[model samples]
Target: MLPLAAGPPFGPEHTMILEQAATALTLARLTSSPAWDRRAHSSVLLDLLHWRYRSRTEARLRAEALGLPTTGHRLVPVVVDHPGAPSADGVALTDHLASELLSSGVKALVGDLAEGRSGLLLALARASAWQPVVERIARELRAAFGPDVVVAVGPGVTELGQVTRSFREAEEVADAIGPASRDRPFHVASDIGLPELLYSLRDDVRLQKYVEQQLGRLVQHDARHGSDLLDTLRAYLDAAGNKSIAAKHVGLSRQAFYQRLHTIERLLGTDLESGAQRTQLHVAVTALESLGPPAELG
Candidate 1:
């Protein structure tokens, strides 16, 4: 068994913990019960605890709250206390209370990854949850954390006796692809499938080569021009192909935007205005999004 501080299901309790989490999700869905929702939240916390917390006592306390045994597992938890209007003490207290709640199994340990606009922006990147859905979460988080706080959640692994490799992988992807600016934030960790695909590519040279061939020119041009043309393209698509808006966003003049578009057209050997061409470009971009950044082509 792993040390109690190492994480979940090291020896005897693994099966039970997993069962409880699964059951909780099932119960919540089947019964439409808030209690089950609470349990699902607890499971999220449990996963976070296994990834972040450092002490056996801490681990035990968190598991116990979730109605799990602390005998064979540890708690790894990440707590983010935003610096917001209510004061540092408030944030600390909230974090402390949150830790206590996790110890009692009240919520997930992955705190809000971003604050205010940044959090909302990150949510916007998710096509699944539309504006209202993200807006509500953002509003609640803003009220709870206070206006100035920015938070983001990193991926975590909770299963005990497992390699730390996956955990480290999640953290690296989170950090590398996490939004540099809160204003235009995105949590790469939240999109589990994409990062998984990205890391998987490290082992698949053939697929990597294919991606390189498709995006080689764009990658090269970005390097040469010192501009994030890829991001610009994404932003343009996200804005529904509005050059004026794209220019305004990146602080370029309309003429410059047109010039860049021409350059992009020339380099990519595709027409942005054509429906068929735009559709293909969108598909390519989505595929590359899952692949993360491309390697420099020879």
Candidate 2:
């Protein structure tokens, strides 16, 4: 509330000014409250994650208002996905995570992405510092949410608009690991290697065409004959072109494995002995695996 002083000369204009001043005061009080602060943080963080702003100037202004550095800093996006039911106090989870990050002396903006998924943008003075900071965040999340949680860290970016790319990479990394994350709860985008490249291009028609061009004949053969030639090929390639090792992996005698290899060569019209051909086939096989149904995280 705002108090006003007036003399006999005061008119209706003065009354209007008083009302506006009181409204402004009320608004200031509301925006300064803790609840409003959390909402603002979440809103701005979501905007950054999705690249929602109209211009770089707009993004920098909003982030600067939140005390996030827009320059001289790199940001790494980390996503924690829990497939279980929400915690009893799920509404407060964002605040809890933010407090934990603060306690560890890490500067971050945290927000709840969904019922069981959370996103964090960690601002670092140096890009190399991301590893230790992400490791610390993983430990904190595991300690709080148990080992079933999947924590994925994406590549770092220097500009705020690039954050959306990092966020998506983190989500894709999480999707790639899926339920297998139970054994290894933490994953970094760089550590995922070839699959990371495949994931980025997983939806391209060219990638699917490449896979079909390399393995279509063999796949058709297996489907029509109920043969395990594809599996044999995978085992063979995994054994680094060593026939004895590949034979043992598929549980076949040397002669039988040789026959299967010959069959594969005839169907695909490619020689497995050529290192270049082997590399192409190996990549195609990996692409096929990556194209399979994505695993659900739990």
Candidate 3:
């Protein structure tokens, strides 16, 4: 309730004016509350993640308003996906994660990403500090959400405009890990070995061409005849050219595996015993697995 003016000169009009002013004040207070601030932070973070600003000046201004670093800081994009979580509210999950990070002395801006998924922009004083920070985030998220939560940490960038690249890398890491991420819930893009190199070139036409050049005939044969020739080749290569071991792994007798290997060599026009050809095919196979299905190449 508003205090009435002294001297009894107030009328109904004055009361109405006071009431309107009080309503405005209440709205202003509401907008400045912590929940509202979280929403604002999320909005700015989504803009950053999507590179929605028209110019760096505009982006910097918005980030500055939210106390987010735009210069003299490195930002690492981290994506978290919890498929087993009970709730599908991404915004609420992000808000909870952001609050937890804040309490742990970590500065992060959170945004919703698909259902049950969240994106975070972690502010770092140095890019080298990302590993520890990401580990801490993974630990916290696992403790809060569950062990099934997947966390993918991308490379750190110094500019706000470059955050989109980091976010995309993180997203790719998450996708590449897929449902097989339970054994290792936390993955950093830079440290994921060969897949990281392949993922970096996922958009290159040459990468797809190389896979086609090396294994296209085998893949086509498998699709046409509904054969396991491609799987046979992979098993053979994975076993380091040991035909017997590869045969056992694929549940085939040595003679049956040899027949498939012979067919593979004939179709691919390469000797399975050539070290150079084996290395080349191995790389192509790795590219196919890392970058997803060969059908996606077309």
Candidate 4:
């Protein structure tokens, strides 16, 4: 017969370990004075993450504040600005975003409000290789909320202290995209182009007047007759004068498309064949779309 063990299987030993863990937790509570549960703990961590992303002062202190797993830098800040989403507050949006990112195999530290953008800070294996991830994240967020979301990525940095620049760059990108802000959807500091530049000047008085002068008749026509002259003109210009292509897009036959195009030329009293005229019409359509509903215009 084998000798009997000193106690039941893992009885006192397990009990002792549990008691030690409990005591340690109690001591920790005394030290921090708060036993952070799930929601509270998450909120606190997010707050710290926001602080670190916004702070450029001391690297060592920021790292210490962020705790483990984020101690190493090489961080890239991504901002998903969903200003047009009908969500109530920043907290709900941030929570949903954090969950989506985690399920997509990206470990993100989310901050509710950072420079008017929902902050998603993460460290990637390759610092300079984060664009595709940003695009995918934007798509996922748009699916979660709605399509009017813009994602801006900051330049990569080797130190946590340098991440604030990334955050600021992202903010600038979100602001610069303006009308195309909804169209571009994803922005990187280095990728801005003519569309973003033109859209950024949407509030220019002359530009607003130009848009109205060019497209206002089409707008009133659409509203009055329930016709689609504005959409037809936009599609026609978008097709670069390819009547068949524009017709296909607008679901009109070639004859019908030409008739509509002729009508548009007559309505605007400008030749659409000239490249300069085409350019002006296209820009005007874009500006009007950016101005939103006619009610807002009124």
Number of the top TM-score candidate: 2
CA RMSD of all predictions: 14.3, 7.7, 9.7, 12.6
TM-score of each: 0.36, 0.66, 0.62, 0.62
Query: Which is the winner by TM-score between candidate 1 and candidate 2?
Result: 2
Is candidate 2 or 4 superior in lDDT? 2
Regions of model 1 farther than 4 Å from truth? 1-207, 225-228, 283-298
lDDT of 2: 0.76
For residues 1-298, could you state the per-residue lDDT of candidate 2 as single tens digits?
8778665897665665565456445545665565665666677778877788766767766666555676888888888887772452563556777777768776677777766777888889864667777777677667776777788888888988889888888988876664333466478765566655665566788988898889988888787788989999999999989999999988999999999999999999999999999999999888777677312100
Candidate 4, 66-168: lDDT as tens digits: 3323544456777777675665344356666766666777755665454345776776665346767777777777776777777877887666655566677
Q: How badly does each model clash, as a count of residue pairs? A: 19, 0, 0, 0
Write down the lDDT of every candidate, Cα atoms only. 0.48, 0.76, 0.76, 0.66
lDDT of 3 at 252: 98
Worst 10 residues of 2 by lDDT: 289-298
Error of 3 at 287 (Å): 2.8
lDDT of 1: 0.48
Residues 1-298, candidate 3: write the lDDT tens digits.
9997679677765665565456445545665566776666667777777788766766666666555666778888888887757533453556678777778777667767767677888887874567777887787677777777889888888888888888888887876564333466478765466655676576688998899899999888888898989889999889999999999999999999999989999999999999899989988988887667755644
Q: What is the lDDT of residue 112 in candidate 3?
A: 70
Clashing pairs in 2: none
Q: How do all the candidates rank in terms of lDDT, highest first?
A: 3, 2, 4, 1
lDDT of 1 at 180: 23
